[model samples]
Target: MCFSMFRSKSKNSSIIQPGKFTPSNTNINPTALNSPSSRSHSQSKSRSNEFNSKSSSISSRASLSSLKDSLPENPHIYDLSEIRSATSNFLLRPFSSSSSSTSWKCLIDKKQLIVTQRKLRRPIDNSELRRKLSLLCKSHHASLVKLHGASVSGNYLYLVYEFICGANLSDCLRNPRNPNFTVLSNWISRVQIIAGIADGLDYMHNCAGFKNGFIHNHVKSSSIVICEEPALVAKICHFGTAQLCGEVPEAISGEDDDDSSNYHVLKRVGSAVGKFVGTRGYMSPEFQTTGIPTLKSDVFAFGVVLLELLSGEEPMKVHVDSGSGAFRKVSLIETAREAVGSGTGRLRQWVDRRLRDSYPVEVADGLARVALECVLEDPGRRPDMGRVAGWISKYYLESKTWAQNIGLPDEITVSFAPR
Candidate 1:
């Protein structure tokens, strides 16, 4: 887990009330994100000023090329000069409002690409972090965005990914630039969105190589981007906060922490501020207390994203009628549980109104039930992402076009073959 959660509550008190929903209560400024737009270069000065200064004696390109040699052979090590030239001087288009990394829409050999730049908050052994990065780069699943190249320096690390030009799921659902962009309309599509994400996480947690597997650590609605170019599908991006299981530095986890063994898997996450890196609402109660993340933690985050997709609400803020004043801020998880407990009419209040008559009541009920189990306060009680994937598959397969829309071949298999 990378970010802070429940700072005001004590370790004991931070525990989830048996059946309450808590929104990821971050004071996020949503508009700070530049909406993934591509623009002409204000970045040109970066080549002469930034890289030139960084590389005074030898060429900047030569310095960057040397860094590239250490990584797995596939990804190119572009010179800082090349990157600055491509992005017009490191003027980044925001990827997410909360993202600490800066990104630019770049063109290489006439192909449009997205390059993200980040600096390590603390020094990490280049070999150790690079090995993990290479695993993700090589582990290409359709739902996982492809890594084009990378440059990992102790000061600043560069990551290049395929730019899925479509809007992120967060913007597409709640604050869509176009009111007509109804890609998230029906139950099948929404279910497909959840399934696609589950598939990617399944692969990462199980298939991605690590002695203990990898954890996305940061899973949320905004982290998911929906692509419509070749087909309609959702993909996860911004791996800047993700970490390998059981590899946390002792200093970050604190040797005296009770969950120290399980907490071993964390990263300093490139922040001078030194707080945890994940959103509060999506974090599992145990992780909030212990600072240790397991595959189950990711499952909990997915559950929150599922709730967001189902309800068409932001994970950070949900409104409840306070009776005395304006709608008070209630956690989305708490609201979800209450909505499910109360009758169908109450549930409808939380459901995204945009779906209108398109959603099937039985399917909605099934989703709520599954999602409820996912957000369970007890980590052991939560289903693994593999089983989570299975639970949502049958309902999604009900739509034949759905598979084709997400670019899955005909006769696709929906079960998770977890190891």
Candidate 2:
């Protein structure tokens, strides 16, 4: 009977009931499980596990934040369909008739942007194009028009830039309806415009930190816009068009003789197809010959623009000879050289008469001399954009001081009464 009772007890222990707890069957102690000290220990263990989980979650979030910070801010590569939809199937009229490239002012994602269409001069690899776009988009300056993004379709690229509300330097300087009137009426206003442009160019040449130096291939009065309200701010347009459209020649570095020669031939042929469209008076002698744009060429264009700012005249115009009644081309550069060389009051006379003798003669002379230095026939002889910008900045300060001393208002306001 004792042996049978022991067997029954062992069998009952093996068959554990669902809701019944036994210390012999389970590793847990029944007395300790219900004790206050044991319950305290259990609560402590649960709290510690919860604290560790929170810490792990915070650590994971920190790691993810760091990863995001390390990555570059890549520009949006838009789908062709998005561009088409925004542009209403390409039926929108161009923003400006004078623009060499077709551009449309359209809204995308509730933001106004200027979309310029450019034909690709050469095929670019997809990865390589994205890399270049990222670098270009990363560059920013107050005086530069921001390139938001780009879209590609087959052989064309649509570059989107933030639309700035202002008049271009060309129209501001010369009003078609009123030739005698100019929005840049005062000397201080003109100084402000040129100074902003100089600062912007200096940033692109020296400070942009591009692997290959950035070049603003199109630097003309027409390509610069002047924001009149708030302040006279100059913003350069077409910041990365050259690189994006493959207009920048590989021979720009002068690394290979054969490549340079081939680039010249290609540029000459491509000019017919609108691949190369340099402004009439802005092209430097070297740029005209080699068809390769460099930093120095940009300096040359800036010089021309400076002269246009100083003297309210077209870059190139026809002067009819009184003696023979024959038309001959008279370049502003030639007149500027003569005015500076004459050593008389001719420079003062050469300056825009609309200034009404309000500007400081000394400052004007110095600025003209700086412009001349930039237009030297030999690109090697011309000063770099950095040096030129520094000179202009100094002149700008002097002009401001002159304006203040003379009690000339920094800005001119125009109002019209109802006719």
Candidate 3:
């Protein structure tokens, strides 16, 4: 499904260090990672070092050669002719978007690749864009799609990424045409997929390149893609909306409310007055009306994704079938909270029916509860990506789907199939 397009972790790799927290930052929004439980703190630190080493290894792979043969224009900027040549006269264009991104499947370095170009819809701070791009390029994690490089070509910014030959999570979860439609419905796969996503967010939030502030800003089912490497690796891909808020508090805490846990905030960096951005169903409520995005805001959107994953329903249009053929719209967040609030009784109402009740009700309830925490109106109350990752990893290791367990790889693009 190339948009003129385009492109996970699984049983074979651990992909997550259970109970460990990584510092979360990406001005797109910030999530806090609590200290690992005392008993496993040392183990968590060891794993963190391993992941940092891997990040350095992947960061070293950005080939300057790719930029050397630049499109006879600005070396930092790509020439339209070069882009056209790489894309075979622009043969694989997916669709056009004035504000949205237009992607293409391209042949580069003798391999299939995904190229995305976006024209700015609103004025974004130039320095913020630079900072975001720098961090974006440095970002390398097993659970995240590798960013090959990016170039400025006229008004549209061009980004190159490794192509994952598969469908996004939304399709795999419910698209009738997806081969994964069956496998993804199981509780094990569901938990693995969500856990894998949390790992990516954990990496982005707590890992390097975001000393400033950065948030995925865009966290949704469509942003998640699953690779069919038997391990069914899931990776987070889109970053067009990602922004870097200049400076923010590393950690904030208050004792006034029960939500006094130390949480990170994703505050506006450059200007207080900025347009709100993000998809409708995925945008955090505060960000929606006031146009402010924080790491907590991104958490809210991620919670929506989890809710969708659990119920197999869109957050905005969720509905239940009526005996008379009429239907009632069900608010995904509110409904999930209510279902989990009931102590797992009638929790079945929120679980996706496609599982046929084969999925574990208990785990389903856990996911709902986690999602409830994420979508809480007070961003401060939302659990940080670190906590979310730990929760998912706990369930992922406990889930029965995986046969072989391996650690997250230094280079996710490396083939993971056993010899």
The best candidate in terms of lDDT: 2
- TM-score for each model: 0.67, 0.76, 0.68
Better model by lDDT, 2 or 3? Answer: 2
Cα deviation of 89, candidate 1, in Å: 3.4
- Candidate 1 worst ten-residue window by lDDT: 1-10
* lDDT string, candidate 1, 257-303, tens digits: 54412323344454343445557588888788766566778888898
Q: Each prediction's Cα RMSD?
A: 21.6, 20.8, 15.6
In candidate 1, stretches whose alpha carbon ends up further than 4 angstroms from where it belongs are 1-73, 76-79, 92-99, 176-181, 244-273, 318-323, 398-419
> What lDDT would candidate 2 get against the real structure?
0.78
**What's the count of clashing pairs in each model shown?**
18, 0, 29
Candidate 2 segments exceeding 4 Å error? 1-73, 97-99, 252-275, 410-419
Better of 1 and 2 by TM-score: 2
lDDT of 3 by residue, 356-400 (tens): 676556667777788888898877678888788888777666555
